[model samples]
Target: MNNVDLELDLNNLKMIFEDLHFNNEIQPEQIPNLDLYMDQVITLFESNLFETKRSVEDKLLTKTMINNYTKDKLLMAAKKKKYTRDHVILMIIIYNLKQSLAINDIKNVLKPIVEKIENNEKVDIDSLYNKYLLIKTNNSEEIKASAEQKLKEVKDEDGDVLLYILSIIDMANGYRKIAEKLIDKFFENTNEK
Candidate 1:
């Protein structure tokens, strides 16, 4: 159930236990309610603990996977103390794209976009893809057309960057869903605070 419901249930249990203890004349039938309330509280606590543990485990796994994947692409060449959602999203996208493109090629293609993002400039995927194709390949027109088509196929949402990255990676590795799940868990944990 929700947090409010869980809190109300726990409070009710405490009140009932206190009342029962204060009045020893309470019947054995009344004891059943206390037992039931205690059981519900325990169950809720266990469920919450399990969810929390699972979320932490999922986050840790995602961190490790992304670290290995982006070891060569990190700007500082050092392990990050904290990774933003954008960073994880980018890593997921790059990991997926690496299936068809070499790591160095992918880095070259993404360097400009990453630089723009770091400078707080709006990134235009279509423009970046076109420029990358023009600079790196002989068939610029054909590559630009294909990349544009792929970019157009991606659905834009509130978190378009994350979705775009996940979609690209998923197209290549089918592990986008797991990354999405981890992202959701990450946000959920943040909201709990």
Candidate 2:
């Protein structure tokens, strides 16, 4: 009963990728300021992020993963075995990034933001996360329109699934790469000041 009955094809993937937006990400302010234990953090992800899950086995997060993220410095250390809103926001970014990029890549990409936090600067995780969300959300419309236009451009009305699928992938990569470039540019501007 838990199995998904959806079929995969270019049209389907196009719609899927188009529908994939990060607006559902947990806002920092939504998390409580009080420190929460590991179990609480898992519960938070499970309940709040469950909508992002494609299946029951697709767990949003786990203790070992959290521990590993902390150990790897991809995440800040939990406070007395508890997590704060900052921790949650960072974890959210990690969760999303890990879907496509490798752990090392994710660590490197987020290093600047994490370092700013470590320096005790008034870095706004909320604003940062919001920016990421904005980038992803804003791209959704462009992705949808681009996919639709490209699909229409195909000579075969029945469609060549392989070609369409590859096009979708290219479009997806284009957006993610652009997001990375934007992030890099933001950090560069910050560094210059």
Best by lDDT: 2
Which structure among the candidates has the greatest TM-score?
Answer: 2
Please, what are the lDDT tens digits per residue for candidate 2 over residues 1-193? 1133334446775667645533566765668888889999899888777777877688889999999998877888877888888888888889988877667667767777777777777878778777887887787677667777776664244446466667778877886788677666553433233
Q: Give the local distance difference test score of model 1.
A: 0.41
The lDDT of each candidate is 0.41, 0.74
Q: Which pairs in model 1 have colliding backbones?
A: none
Deviation from native of the Cα of residue 10 in model 2, angstroms = 11
Find the 10 residues in a row with the least total lDDT in model 1: 22-31
Looking at model 1, residue 60 earns an lDDT score of 20
